[model samples]
Target chain A: MSYKLQFAELLPYWNVLLQGLIFTIVLTVVSTVAGIAVGTAGASARTFGPVWLGRIVAVYVELIRNTPFIVQLFFIFFGLPALGLKLSETTAAFLAMVINLGAYSTEIIRAGIEAVPKGHIEAGLSLAMTKWEVLRRIVLNQAFRKIYPALSSQIIIVMLGSAVVSQISAEDLTYAANFVASRNFRNFEVYLLAALAYLVLAMLTRSLLRALGRVIFKAR
Target chain B: MLQFSFWDILSNLLIATQWTIVLSLIAFVCGGIVGLALLFMRTSRIPALEWFTKVYIEFFQGTPLLMQLFLFFFGIALFGFEVSPWTAATLALTFWTSAFLTEVWRGCVESIPKGQWEASSSLALSYIEQMRYVILPQASRIAVAPTVGFSVQVIKGTALASIIGFVELTKAGTMLNNATFRPFLVYSLVALIYFCLCFPLSWWAKKIEGRLNVAR
Candidate 1:
């Protein structure tokens, strides 16, 4: 089987790919920030909030963690409309990703939060810090430092998982590949390029997140 | 007008779930075999094989399963063979599963103390015999919980197979949602079914993991 690679066939479609890549990056950025916020908040609730709230958070984490992200995406994108809520494809994609990442990172950050010793909290309390202040300044800072590596990896995982958003026609990188391939009949070439793009994106995101961690946490 | 009651949507979903389970088992079993091979090569002290395995893992883990599925589904056809959705989905998922399981098991093997290998080598045990008698027995015990945990991932991964036109649970949900125009009910039921299948396995994995930690 002699198949020639025709990357040249894709030159006319560079702008399309760029648009898709931008969408992908934007989705990743928005979801990562919002997801981590939800995760951190849920972690604190599980760790320090009322028992019933903890149970509710536990249920949310379990339900999200156990199911497939595509199912969740479809549920939100298609199902929510039935309940009188209509969301754009991009909005649904964003919501699904945030919800998905939030659940997984809840477990990850909760582990970090649990690693904080009781004495640290006690110290913060003894220093005349309010409970909210102690959790924000002391517990959260230490927790983020302890779990940044795992959290960053989870973020990368979510970025990779974002390829499924194209399934709902959000026009992300994978959707661009589909568009170009269908037009040019270069399925193999198109997907290969898109996969490389994703590889580079994953590596770039990991390094960026690492650097961000260094800047924020200020490693001694 | 075509009609699907609650039970109709549910029973159809239950039937499609069979495909999901089957696809997951194929991936897990096939991937376990390939992953075990990769693990041996990775730990065999051979530089070329070790590097190759590492790159293989990174490539799979770094990219999304959806793209991999698309590639294999279309890529294999370039090699002058017909590519069925079943074969494509299974191949992509197997490779993906092998990469992750290899890494997981490699960690388990590496966690074993250095003395075990030395003791076995001093006794003139062949590498295979050493692995069989001294190394793998210990490592397999450590591997059980995580391997089961990874099964949940495999099950979830099968959902991506739907994009390639495999009639799995997620695909079934979409079809039902279209037919009944009851997206909320159909999808919620689908998520619940997945929850039932996966939550127990995840719980078991954590329970065993906790016990293993205590034992250690």
Candidate 2:
């Protein structure tokens, strides 16, 4: 089979590329927020909650971490309907992203939690702070500051992971590239462009997270 | 409702796990060799090689493995080579794993104290001899915990192979779930098997890291 180079053909799809980038950014932000929330709860549960609750949360994180997100996506998309709980494909994808992100983030955040000195916790308690307040005002703040870099790295991973949403056909960047490449018959160039776009996006995410850490953790 | 005989799935999950193991091994073996080359290239004096290595690391580390899988499965087909699902998945996962491993190893190597290199130089060891005898022996210790930690990622990564119709545990679960019309049961079983596979390794990695902390 002979091939044709069509770099010019891809130029017209700039809007789609932009939309794909926005879609990816939106998914990453949503998942990052949701994942952090879930992870914090999971971490708390494992550390301070009732024994049964901690066990359950531990099991949840490990199961999610061990399995592939694609499988979890299919399970939500295809499996849940049989149980009469139908969700939009986007909703299912979003949920899968949150769950997947939560597991990895739990590990990262938990490391931060552990790194907080025991004396810090005692100092907060001695200052008359409630258990919850101490965990919030001292332990977690310090922990987050310390693990911010790893957390940012994980967020970048999740940002690119948004591409997997295409399995359910969420129309993210990679999905759009597949469409453009198939239509233009310039698969190699289209994918190369897509990869470059992703590389740029990842770097941008890293720099943005670094800046955010600087602003939020000014004590550092 | 998606339902099937429970026992049948047990056997299929077991069998499919073998494919997952096989895929992980292929990717690791191939990725290890490629990763070593990338680490060397990144450490080399050649500017072109250094730029190439950075571009490669950024490219792979930036993108999602799913996209990489899709790009490889479909992209390579456009190069006039008909590709099987296994061929596509192996190529993609191996490519992705190498970049991360290279960086991990590079960090381990760099973490070696500068004095060790200096001492080797003072002893009249050539650069190659220094690396083989002094630098590497030390770096290898630093690399252990992280290497084991990364294998968890490599193991989980094999599950993506299922997307291209490579029937690993995840793919098997999907197929079984579809035919049996039992998503929760099937995938729960799928998740359990993976937990069993991964938890031991996770515990081992943590143990090593704990020991490394003590040693340091």
- The C-alpha stretches of model 1 lying farther than 4 A from their native spots are none
Off by over 4 Å in 2: A182-184, B1-4
- Residue B144 lDDT, candidate 1, scale 0-100: 92
- Model 2, A82-165: lDDT tens digits are 788998877988898999999988888888999888999999999999999998999888889889999999898888777778
Clashing pairs in 1: none
How badly does each model clash, as a count of residue pairs?
0, 4
Give the per-residue lDDT digits (tens) of candidate 2, residues B82-121.
9999999999989999999999999988998889988989
Pairs that collide in candidate 2 are B2-B181, B2-B182, B3-B180, B3-B181
The CA lDDT at B50 in model 1 is 96
State the DockQ, from 0 to 1, for candidate 2: 0.57
* Tens-digit per-residue lDDT, B1-216, candidate 1: 977888889999999999999999999999999999999999998999999999999899999999999999999998899999999999999999999999999999999899999999999999888888999999999999999999999999999999999999999998998888888999999999999889999999999999999997
Per-residue lDDT of model 1, residues A1-220, tens digit only? 7888888999999999999999999999999999999999999999999999999999999999999999999999988888889999999999999999999999999999999999999999999999999999999989989999999999999999999999889999999999998899999999999999999999999899988988998956
**iRMSD per model?**
0.7, 2.3
> Would candidate 1 be rated incorrect, acceptable, medium or high by CAPRI criteria?
high
Model 2, position A167: C-alpha lDDT score: 76
* Cα lDDT over the full model 1: 0.94
